[model samples]
Target: MNGKPAVFLDRDGVINEDRGYVHRWEDFSFLPGAIDALRQLQQKGYLLVVITNQSAVARGLCTEADVLALHERMCAFLRERGIELAGIYHCPHHPQGSVSDYAIACACRKPEPGMILRAAQAHGIDLSRSLLVGDKISDLEAGRAAGIPSLYLVVPPGQDEDLSSLPGVQRVSGLSEVVERMFGSQAMPSS
Candidate 1:
């Protein structure tokens, strides 16, 4: 906490309900306990950062501006709750994108460490002390690649991701469990 260790979060599924490339504010919904979890982490003095991949932009489902607008909406919600974000980094590129400008194999995409690394540089984050929470394997991979010490997989109950073989990665059923696992259940979320 003294050195600006960050809690890097994936946007979809981790923060918002992932209803297939959700880009509009109307479609956005905070996952249960996400706000509380984030508030708890923030109270512990961890920088809250979001690193996500929005391939929907590449597929023309939405524009980059739409993605930014969605992030603004998310931040607005957090601000209303008295929480602040350190940074929001997203990659709109896809290797097989329909849009030529985003078609290349970009390093910012998840499973790669570009976005997280860049955010660390921009926000003075200590990657060695950082933690990442994501809902998928690729999210864990990105944290591993970025040299983050911890990775938490947020999977629903009865779902076995079978990722136990991986070192330093733990699985949690929800964001509340994420805060519990890292900081113990006694660490209550601040209002």
Candidate 2:
């Protein structure tokens, strides 16, 4: 497949409230302006993919099937909003997990860039031209390791997090700020 630019996103904290390992649909709440921001990005013709670390599965908080179910619902909801996701990838392994099946250290986990690398190969995404927006420093490191050109660190709403000015890293209060800068006053689709 010919290569195309894609936007790699982190699920927790960035997309939904980081309310501690959301495995249920009822507890999943979209952050304020998240849907609108997503719509704007969708309109901009970017291949949107979700990359997340779900060690809850390894910690026995939930099952892999539960995560898949939640993602199915998420994609359906996005479709209702006229947005399409290229893919949703999660790392279920934890180094110190209680569950034996998912306890081993894996490469897909954040700060490793394994998931991004796999997604790029699977979807033919041009890593050099792609972008990653996540809420943690690990996310930035993963994007950097994957060679994504644009990386934005999103701070959760109302968080008093202070990050030292880092070269090649832009800090954002939320997803809306990134959307505003990337698309300016254009590409926002009516919700």
Query: Which structure among the candidates has the greatest lDDT?
Result: 1
Query: Which pairs clash in the backbone of model 1?
Result: none
Candidate 2, residues 19-59: lDDT per residue as tens digits?
Answer: 99999999999988888888778777779999999999999
Across 1-191, the per-residue lDDT of candidate 1 in tens digits comes to 23689999998989988899999999999998889989999998899999999999899889999999999988998999989999899999998989888877989999999999899988888998889999999999999998898899988887888786677688888778888877785788456
Using all chains and alpha carbons, the TM-scores for the candidates as numbered come to 0.95, 0.93
lDDT value for candidate 1? 0.90
Candidate 1 runs further than 4 Å off: none
Off by over 4 Å in 2: 157-166, 187-189
| TM-score of decoy 2 | 0.93
Candidate 2 residue 107 Cα shift, in angstroms, is 0.7
Every candidate's lDDT: 0.90, 0.88
